[model samples]
Target: MGKLVTVGEAGEAVVLERLLAALAVPASVSGVEAPLLGPGDDAAVVVAPDARVVATTDLLVEGRDFRTDWSSGADVGAKAVAQNLADVAAMGAVPTGLLLTVGAPSDTPLAWLEDLGRGVAAACSVWSTSVIGGDLSGASELLVSITALGDLQGRAPVCRSGARPGDVLALAGSVGRSAAGLALLLAGGPELAEEVAPELLAAHRRPVPPVGAGPAAAAAGATAMLDVSDGLGVDGARLAAASRVHLDVDADWEDQHVLDLLVAARRLGGDDDPWGYGLVRSWVRGGGEDHALLATFPAGVAARGLPEPFVRIGEVLPVRSGWPAVTVNGDDEVVGGWDVYA
Candidate 1:
C-alpha cells in the first residue's frame, strides 16, 4: 500500500499544489549528498553532478487515444506514467520522478481521480519512483498529460543517432498485442465473446513498460535506443535516418499467428473484419500506446541481465536511398509501418 493524498481533503483545484510540498527526502547523486526537495518552494532542485537532466512528456485525449468503456481510471493512470517513463528508459536513463496534469468533467467522481492517483503510484513503484507534482483542471472530457524526469548516472544520454552499420537490432517487448485488442474493441456487439489476453488488453489500457532494460542496454553499450510508441516501420525508418543506416526485418508469420488467432476468435464470435480493415496492422506498426523499448546493439555483444519480453528483431546496414521495407519470408508482401501524420 502507498500513501494517499486526496482532493477531498485539499478541496478542488488545489490538491496537487499541496502534494508538491510534501515530497522531501535525502539521497546521493553522483557520489554527492543531496536532498529531494521535490516540486515545492517555487522550483525543485537536485544535485546536477554532471549538469544534465533528461525529460519528456506526453498527452492522451479521451476519444482520440482511449475510451472509458474500454478502460478504468486505474488503467489510464498507469498508462499515462508508463509512456513518458519509457521515453526516459529509451535514453538509458533511470526514471526518478513524475509530474502529472489531469483534466476531466466537473461531475467526475473524486474516487476516480483517487484511483488514477493510485495507478500513478503503482506504476512509479515499479521504478522505485514517485509522482512529485501535478496540476488538475475541469474539462469536458478526460485528458492526461504527464512529464517524466530521469538521471543518466554519468553516461552519455543515448539518442536515435547512434546506430552503426552491422549493429544487431533488438526489441525489448512483444508486438501487436495492443493492436489485436483494438481489433476486438471495434468489432463490438452481443456477439463479442472472444477472450482477449488479459495482458494484451492491459497493454492497450495500462501498458507496463520494461523499466529495467534501459540501464541494462546502456551497461551493455547499446548503440541506439527508443520506445516504440509509433509503428515499428515508421520508428525503424526514423532510426535509419538518424543513424544514416538501413534497418531490415524478415517478416515472420509466427508473430502474426498470435494476432491472427485472436482476431479469428473475435470473428468466430460473429464480428466483422475490422481487424483486417488495417486497424491492427497499422497499430502494430503505427500505434502509440504500447510503450515497448526498441534498441540497436553491436553485433555479437553479449547482453547481460535482460529478462523475458525482449528479442533480437533485425539488423542495421549502410544507408541507402529508398523506402525502408519489411519482407515476409518467401512471400512478396512488402508491408511498411504506420505514421500518425503521414
Candidate 2:
C-alpha cells in the first residue's frame, strides 16, 4: 500500500492523476481488472452476461448517515458500498462493478480520502467486484454516492411482490445489533470499557450485509425477497404490503443473543427502559440498519434445503380483517419503523 499524501503536504495544486493513481493501484492489486476501460478514461464499459443489468444507487451524508467522531473514513466508505451492493444482491444478481462519487470540503485530508479508496477497494474485492470509475468534487460537507451494477445470469430478478399465503418467512443474517450499537454511542457507553459492548459498537461502525444470501435464496426458489435496511417491522411491512400478505413474526426473545444484547443495553444506561420487555422488543423488532436479508420460501422447502445462515422465524398468512401488515407473536402489531422525515 502506498503512503497517503496529506493535504498539507500536497499543497494547493491538486493533481487528479496522483489521487486517482493512489486509488487505482490498490484496486489493480486487488485483482480488479477493467472489463473494457477503468479509471483514466472518459467512461467504463462493463460486460453484461445476461443482456440485462441490475443497478441501484444510495447516498451517505456525513452528519446524517455518519459522524467522524464515531466512524473512521474507511468505515464510512465500506458501509456506503455495502448498502448499495446489498440492494443489487436483493434482486438476485451478482455484483459486477461500482461507480463512486465523493464530495468534500477543501480542508478534507488527502490521507482520509486515500483510506476511503482503500475501503472501497477492500469491499469490492470481497464480492469479486470492480471499482470501474468515479468522480470527485468539492462540497460543503462530506458526501458519498455509490451506484452499483449487477448481472442476473439468466435468473429472474427476485422481487418483494411474490410472497403468498403459506410461505415460510426466513432470515439470512442477524439484526438489532446495529441499533443497539447506535444507542450505546448516543449514551456514551463506548467511553466506558466493557466486554460485549465493543462488538455492538463495531456493528454500528460497519455493518456486514449478507451479500451472497440473496442469490442463494433465489436459487432455492424464494418467492419474495428484500434486504432489511430499515427496521424489520418497517421493511417487513413494506414487503407484506407489496405482496398483499400478512407476516406473523415470532421472534425468539428468549434466544441467548437477544438476552446478551438486553444486558448490554441496560449497562449502557440509556434513556430507554432497557429492562422492560417493550424496549427490548423494540430493538429486536423495530430497530434497523443491520441490512440483513428477509426472504420467503415455498412451504415444502425444509430447513436443510435452504441456504446456510437462513433461519425460519415466521410464516406468511392471509390478510385478515382488522389485522395490520405485520403482527408479532400473533397479537402485537407494529405500526411503523424508521422514518427519515419523522
Candidate 3:
C-alpha cells in the first residue's frame, strides 16, 4: 500500500527466485550460516546436534490472524516468525532454522514482498537462526506459514505436564500490552490521532517473546513450560489441566504498566473504573498474542536460580475437589481468550 511496486510482467518463476534471494542473502550476510545443504533443493537438510529437533508450525491468514489495513507485510512476517519461534523455545530449545511459505494475490506489490523477506530475516537474526528454505504460491489473499526447528542441546524437552503442587509459577516478558494496543486500534486511535505511543503500537505489530527465558527456566529446573500465545487465564488453565494442578495467580495489580493501560483506556473512552469492573484486569488475565513464557519451577529453585524478567506471579496448588484448572485470587470465572471457532 505504501509506494507500491508491483511484480510486473516478470512472471512467477523469476519473481519467486528474486524473493528467495532477497530473504536468504541478507541472513547469510548477517552471519547466519545455512546448513550443509541449504535452499534450492528438494528439501533442506538441517543438523540436529542433540539428536532431538524441536519443530513447530504456525499459519497466519489474512483477515483471520491479521488485517492488511492494520499491519504491514513486514509486521505480518515478524509476527509469524515470533509465534513459531516461541513455540520452539517453549520446549527448552534453541531455534536453528526456519522454513517459510508465502501465498499472495498476483496484484500484491513486489516491494511488500521484499519487506516481508527482510522482516523474516531480521526476526531469524535476532535468535541467530537461518532461513533455510521456503515456497511461494499464488492465492486469493495473503497467507504466511512458518516452520521452525530447534536444538535441545542434550537437555530434556520440558513439557506442560511436569508441573507439580508447591511449584512457583513465573512469567517472562509482559502481558496485556498487545491487547491494550488492539483495543486502541479498534477505538480508532491509530487513524484518528496523529501520534501514538510506539510501545503500544509495536506491541500489537511485533511481539518480542522472551526467547532466552525458556532455556534459562529449563536450566533452573522448571517443571512445566508454555508460551502465553493465548491469554494468561486460558493458557494457565491449559497448563493446569495438563499438570493436573491448580494454578493460583495472586499478583498485585498496582504495577505501573497496568496503571498506564488503565489511563490509556480512559482516554480512549473506556469507563473510569476500568480496573474495578475487571476490564483492564481482564486484558492481563485473558489477553492473547503476547507470546510470553509462563513456567513453573520448584519453590527454592525459582527463588534462587530463575533469572531476570521472570517474575513470580502465582503458585501451584493440589487439585482440590470440584475446582477449576486455573483460578485468580481464588476466582475461577476469569477464563476467556482467542478461540478460532468461538
Which candidate leads the pack in lDDT?
Answer: 3
Q: What lDDT would each prediction earn against the true structure?
A: 0.67, 0.78, 0.81
* 1 or 2, greater by TM-score: 2
Ranking by lDDT: 3, 2, 1
- lDDT per residue, candidate 1, 1-342, as tens digits? 133344444466454533332222222312223326655455555544556779899997887777777877777878888889889998988877777788877666556676677677667666677766667787888888999888898888889999998887788865566665665667652124236445556567777778778877887888999887765766776777788887766455335534643553445343465445344545455555566787888876735533334567767777655545332342332344544445
Location of the lowest summed lDDT over 10 successive residues in candidate 1: 23-32
Off by over 4 Å in 1: 1-35, 46-50, 189-194, 253-283, 302-309, 325-342
TM per candidate comes to 0.80, 0.90, 0.92
| Regions more than 4 Å wrong, model 3 | 1-4, 25-29, 192-196, 253-257, 269-277
Model 2 lDDT tens row, 1-342 = 244355445543453554565455454566665657676688988989899999999998888889877788888888888889889888888888888888877778787777787777677777778777888877899898999999888899999999999999988876787888887777665574235578777777778889998888888888998988887888999899999999998756325337757755676544666464555566777777778888999888844567867888889999887788888778888654755656
Tell me the tens digit of each residue's lDDT in model 3 across 1-342: 334366544557766766776676454456766686778899999889999899999989898888877888888888999999889888889888889998988888887787888788778778778778888888898889999999888899989999999999889988887887887777775663224445766888889998878887777788999999888888998899999999988746324337756654565644666343356677778888889999999998976867667888889999987877777767755577787866
Cα deviation of 129 in candidate 1 (Å)? 0.7
Provide the clashing-pair count of each candidate structure.
Answer: 2, 0, 0
